[model samples]
Target: MDKHTIMQYFEWYLPADSQHWKRLAEDAEHLSQIGIGMVWMPPAFKATGLNDVGYGIYDLYDLGEFDQKGTIPTKYGTKDDYLEAIQALKQHGIRPIADIVLNHKAGGDELETFQVRKMNPTNRQEALSEPYEIQGWTGFTFPGRQKQYSDFNWHWYHFDGLDYDALHEETGIYQIVGDNKGWADQNQVDTENGNYDYLMFDDIDFKHPDVVAHLKEWAQWFLETTGVTGFRLDAVKHISEDFMADFIAYAKTLQPELYAFGEFWKDDIDTTLRYLDGTNYQYDLVDVGLHMNLYQASQNGADYDLTTIFDGSLVQIKPQSSVTFVENHDTQAGQALQSKVEDWFKPIAYGLILLRQEGLPCVFYGDYYGIEGDFAQPSFQEDLDKLLYLRQHYVYGQQTDYFDHPNCIAWTQSGDEEHPQSLAVVLSNSEAGWKRLDMGTLNAGKTFVDYLGRCADKIVIEEDGWASFPVQGGSISAWIEESI
Candidate 1:
């Protein structure tokens, strides 16, 4: 069908060596074989140090080529090595979705310009303007007592500490406090008014015209060079809503069909929909909050009953808007399909998402074959291939109808207008080995087959048009009528 398929890449997956590049290319091939139409690679731009997670960027143009241990990977060959991976994916009909980090930067007053301003010994106002803060979530504990910008040492500015005000234009240095050394690190600025530090890494003054231009430049380059299908804008909430509108508008000029989605972390429907209104929502957001409900129900041994999540107030959104995902890098790892409780839970979860009407469905790499690692693992090509085949033939590009019952939750997906035959899925949330479902209006006296297990069963529709059958042990499926 016309469903948008995406594969998420964790930050730790990108290797720093040539051997790693080869392995990554092979992984891309595996995903394409499994019917994945798009791949979202983690951030690969330049960074300050060994940031296994690439959110902390150092330069926009540099593609992490300092060294294997360092950000750059000349050791991994050259920039060409990276491009080869992208091209290889394209050959397999998979589009690349680059994860852009436009939020914050690393802190250290090592650059000469920033250090001069911090130690200005003269006017301190100019020093406070430097990009001083690190993004909040890194788990560093900065001393609360060192409040003044001058009192703190700049070298101590690590991933754990945040310095919100550290810019000094007079000295052209980013003034950051050091914890142990009692000195400030001086940072140099490449742009006029020492604005590069603010624009490239830290939260930029989004209202500034220059900031808008800088973002546009990156978008243009990305579209022109990589031919990426879309972007997963990182930290979009931190930027002003107005700036997002303007930036997306400019990006359209480069590729009119380019899809862009923002990461707005919230579970409530109203709160999530608020960000989607009045903006260029070509591809708006992923209903993470709704996914959470389904995930919780699965984990709680509710047998993947997805009624509460699907039956919630329907969000009136563009057909291809929101991106739906069960579990991502930030959330708890999805349950292993090998585990009895989790095995049936995943397929049922995918059933709910892929058969839904609102957004495109995303399948986490780990969910395919129950990989247990945090980030990278060997490919699950066999399982993924079968699942994708089923998704493309059955659920993808289909119109969905949702139904709910106290004992079970089910949905019907029909082919497009031209081909209307449909598949119905009913999931039982009981752990007593099996549960019976009354199929209302489902055709009776026809042979039905479970595609996953290749099991065949007869559907005997009663006089009341109800079909009763014991759902396969700990599993869900696409039940197709033999007559149709």
Candidate 2:
């Protein structure tokens, strides 16, 4: 199998307009200029019928062609507009990875029907049919306690500004209540259930064969139509593991090289590895625990040692598993660890992960340009230059070596036969003025250059055969020169 590296741009907050298509085309061109190999675009389907996050999906087939956002006129362009963006990326040698949400659909339509029940007191039983509550994270809670919607207002909707339907005794679908309440007057659903309103989203029954077939068809259509190289599965833990295994296997048949990874959202390495066991790692996963460790270490001003974290979990992962990125859209920002984007820890984290030999490395879009506040205003051109250059020139097709170290972490990458490029990176977050370390395993008495700062240091082997050097405080990283 050919190894691939990724420089991901999470276009999550991209505007839902025709202008965005042009902007994305420009962005794809820019990424290619900077040597980014893969670009990950956010979900482009219809909005969840609630927020603009795109995760709250209403219909999988509709790519935002509703009455409200008439912006996406098929007359303006067909799915071809998106394909053009992908083609532009391919022209620049950049692969496009689409971020997909297969777990659930926005239960908005269900909530709307439930609201009608509460307004009319004539048919109280229909309004009070089967009431179900959401049992996951909704980003809100009442003071002094944490509970589902059932624990709170039974009548209010949790997440949607509609009412929950009373369960029908015969069919599983909740019965809708009819009332004279105006659609605008319906209260916004709290993250919790209502006391009087009774609004809960209709969760997708993954156990249903029709639902599974629908998901597979959607995946097949995306791959066959857009020529998307891979997928980043959202909220995989919420759905059945078997469903994912089958879905991934089916997707690979369409595009054999397609890489599908999921966000399992667990800290335990064993638990995370379980999802990959039977499937030959068809569903690769990001290392959320290691990401958290790096963030925590940066905040404490401690040396960010990549080896320590890898030693704890790398053995458990499949050799071809995915292993890129420290901070993603879902995690805390890299700037959250410190106020500055140029913080030593940030570069060190990037260098170590990008040069590692194990899993493919991923570069977050915001991390490329020090995006501080909101993702909406992210600047992508600046920091991406250095990273994209390094990924292409040094990291791509290179064999990785994890150098032995305590406080300082280091790695070296040697390019393939056709591309004889090599680079070594060493990072120390310690405050010590100077530190000496062994580089005997690498070429002795050879000159090594730092890629980021352009500083060069000559390796000198002492009488005892140990390479020593001065490692400064904050963070220091160096890459060795290689025959191009």
What lDDT does candidate 1 reach at residue 358? Answer: 62
Q: If scored against the real structure, what TM-score would every candidate get? A: 0.71, 0.71
Predicted candidate 2, C-alpha RMSD: 10.8
Error of 2 at 160 (Å): 16
User: Tens digits of per-residue lDDT for model 1 on 1-484?
Assistant: 2545787754233344534345557778777666788877666565555534566654454454434234344322345566776787788878877777766555322432222123222332255434343322222112321322113222223321233323322222233444332211222111223222332233344434544565677677667766766788876654556667677777777788777777765566655556677454544776666566666666766544445655432233434566777666666433222222144466666666665556667776556544444533444344445456656666633444444454465555555554444555656555322223433443445455555553356555565545554455445656655565
lDDT score of model 1? 0.52
Q: With candidate 2 superimposed using the best TM-score fit, by how many Å does residue 312's alpha carbon deviate from the native?
A: 3.6
List the lowest-lDDT window of 10 residues for candidate 1: 182-191
Candidate 2 Cα outliers beyond 4 Å, as residue runs:
1-3, 11-18, 49-51, 65-80, 110-201, 278-280, 303-307, 314-316, 333-343, 372-384, 395-406, 414-421, 432-445, 454-466, 482-484
C-alpha lDDT values of all predictions: 0.52, 0.53
Candidate 1: segments with Cα more than 4 A from true spot: 11-21, 27-30, 65-71, 74-78, 107-201, 303-305, 311-319, 333-344, 369-384, 396-402, 416-421, 432-445, 454-456, 460-466, 472-474, 481-484
Window of ten residues with lowest summed lDDT in model 2: 183-192
- Clash number for model 2? 28
